[model samples]
Target: MNRFGTVVIGGGQAGLVMGYHLKRRGEDFVILEGHPRIGDSWRRRYDSLRLFSPPRYASLPGLPIPVDDCPTRDEMGDYLEQYAAHFELPVRAGVRVTRVSRDAEGFRVETDEGEYLADQVIVAGGSHAVPQRPAFASELDPAIRQLHSLEYRNPEQLADGTVLVVGAANSGTDIALEAVKTHRTLLAGRHPGQVPVDIDSGRGRMMLPIVMFVFRHVLTRRTPMGRKALAEREGHGVTLVRNKLADLDAAGVVATSRIESVRDGQPVTAEGDILPDVGTVVWCTGSGPDHSFLDLPVFEGGRVRHERGVATGEPGLMFLGLEFQFAVASGTIQGLDRDARYLLRQLRQNTVRSASRPVTVDRR
Candidate 1:
């Protein structure tokens, strides 16, 4: 079996950042990516996707984004590939991790290619493992095209009719605005809120640093307000940034109640209004990490039991890129820098503690 000092179970921003820190410390590690390319995850996103943050906030630790303006999905993807190449980070693409379990020596990483033995493992694979959709989605009319936001590419993918976009969050609003250009669009569900100012405006740019500071430092797991925000974050979608409720209205997209069920081969909302003319239903509901492959007792109440991304019960196991892991920005690119540093420090401390312990010999 292949062996390394550490194995990172992703090649995205989080994993790459972890690899960067590990490399800085001259640690042996490998980043395993399921996709064939380093940044295919971003490349695979919907075409209209762009970074909500400006170039400064969108960059990784070592490399600045090549764009001065908000970057497109492809630009971000290419930049990630560039970052990996520039750093010469050890990455193994096209290696799908099937399971990760504890071994006598350390940890066993099972993948489609082969097995790997590592003294430590870092899961920076992100939270969106599976595309989430309601069970009733299967009950929709077979003739009506249905897709999760993850599968949505462009309006060209939709059929020739009105489109019903479920989940009135950022993705849903963005898709609705796009769909309105070609087809009649209906946006459902209530948005959490909107940013007080336009993020791209001059004043917003000036305020970006302050907002980011609050998100990164003030609103952290250590603060009471941050803990409250984390508790509420699970139910609330991120506040709208680029697109607002006014934009959706101005774009002629009809806003409706949340989708509760399906009736007569159509989508029915909470108010019992059935949308019969919705030729396409785009589910923009959020997704969660699929930790089913993890064979560890590190979960509590359906969530990973961790203290700021460090697995509490499991040694040599760490998680990165989890929403609200330490702060509201924990899942963002800029957040990885600090998270990686903290985790690595913890790892070093653990190693030192392990090494300093007195060796007990077994008497037979």
Candidate 2:
């Protein structure tokens, strides 16, 4: 089996960042990507998809996003591809991790191509593992086109009809606003709220770093306010970015209460209003990480047993890019830099502890 000092799953931003740190420390590591190319994840997103963050906020540790303005999906993808090449990050593409399990020495990473052995493993796959939707979706009329936010590429994919976008999160808001350009759209859900100012405003620009600092340092698992906030926001969506309520209103997108059920194959909102003419249900509910392939007993209470990205129960196993793994920005590109450095420190501590243990020579 191909052995490495560390095996990093997912060659996206999080894994790439981890690899960068490992390379800096002169550690032997490999980044395994499921896709055929680096940044294909971003490339597969909707054509109109743009980052919620500015160019400055959207960057890896040492590399910056090569754009002055808000980057589009294609630009972000290209940047990631170039980053891997420039850093010479040891990445193996087209390798889908099937399972990761503990072994006698350390861990075994099973991929579609082959199995690899590593002294440590890091699962850096971000939260968007599976597109989440309601079970009632199968009950929707067969004629109606149903698409999750993850599968949605462009308005051209939709048939001619009114589109009902469920969930008012950032992706939902973006999709709802975009869908209105081509079809009569109705956004159904409780408003999760919006950013008070346009992201490009001077005040907004000034607040970006401050907010990131708060997310990174001020708010953490140790603080009371942070604890409350994390619990309250669990399963909730991100605050609106770029778009706002006025934009939706101006575009004639009807906002309504959450869909409670579907009666007679029609969507019935919590207000008892039946949406009968919605020919397309674009679900923007959200997604979660798929840890089913992980054979460790580390997942507890819907979270990996890790403190600041290091596995708590299992030694030599770590997780990266988990939402709020350390702070509010834990899974974001802006947060990767700090988290990577912290993880490296933890790894070094572990190495020292292992080495300090006295070796016993066996004589027969």
Candidate 3:
């Protein structure tokens, strides 16, 4: 089997950044990617999708954003390809990692292409791999076409009748807005807190400096709703209409409370209101971590236990690009860079320790 100093799983931003750092340190490592090409995940996103943050914050280590202002999704993809080429990162694409286990030697990575033995392993797949659909959704009638946000491309694929979009996050909101142009759309779930796509606009430019202070230093996700309301109104980009759900109801788009049950080809709301005539039900719930391939004792309480990106209780096992791994920004493209750098430092320390170990021979 081929052996490596380190093996990084998933070729996204986190993996690429780790590879760059490993190269700089003169470490022998390889990146394993499930996709056929680099940045295929970003390229497959909806055509209308763009980075939530500005281009200035979207760059990885040693590579600047394409222009300087705001780079589109396609531009981001191209930049990643360029980043990979510039570093000459050793990436084995189209190789799906099936399992990772520990033995006396170290990590044993089994993939579709072949097996690899690595002294260390880095799992950087992030959280979006597994789509989370509601369990009750399966009980719905087979006639009602149900799709997750991951599978949703455009409104054309939906049935010719009314469409119900559950969850009001970015994907849910964008999908609802897109579907409204064609089918009667009903947006369900709590209103989402939003920020302006361009925070440095006409009036926003003047308050730009204060915006950072409020979002970072003062306001937080854990703030009280009243305090959050102040920031939500002033800093939050959009306002939820007093009766946004009610508006959908008035527009012939049924506005129901949380889904309770589905029986006889119908969705029964919490109030026992049954909407039987709905054609499509798009579940934009979200996703969970798909770590089925991870075979280690590092995971604790359903999450990988790591101290500042270094896996605890297990030597030479680390995780990067996990949601809230250290901070709320840990999973973001910008945040992965910091985690990658920290992980690289830990890896270098490990290498030094291994080299300094005293060699002892076994005498039979």
Candidate 2 local lDDT, 246-353, one digit each (tens): 999999898989987888888889989889778899999988887878888998897678888898878788888889888888878888888888877777655412
What overall lDDT goes with each candidate model? 0.87, 0.85, 0.73
Question: In model 3, which regions exceed 4 Å deviation?
Answer: 67-69, 196-256, 351-364
Over 167-265, each residue of candidate 1 has an lDDT whose tens digit, in order, gives: 888899989999999999998887789988898899989999999999999999899999888888876677888887788888899989999899988
Which candidate order results from sorting by TM-score in descending order? 1, 2, 3
Could you give the C-alpha RMSD of every candidate to the true structure, in order shown? 4.3, 4.2, 6.2
Ranked by TM-score, the better of candidates 1 and 2 is: 1
Model 1 ranges off by over 4 Å: 351-364
In model 1, the Cα lDDT at residue 234 comes to: 72
| TM-scores, each model vs. reference | 0.95, 0.94, 0.83
- Superior candidate under lDDT, 1 versus 2: 1
Model 3: per-residue Cα lDDT over 103-134, one tens digit each = 86678999998888777899887468787776
Of 1 and 3, the candidate ahead on lDDT is 1
Give the residue spans of candidate 2 off by over 4 A.
Answer: 349-364
* Candidate order, lDDT descending: 1, 2, 3
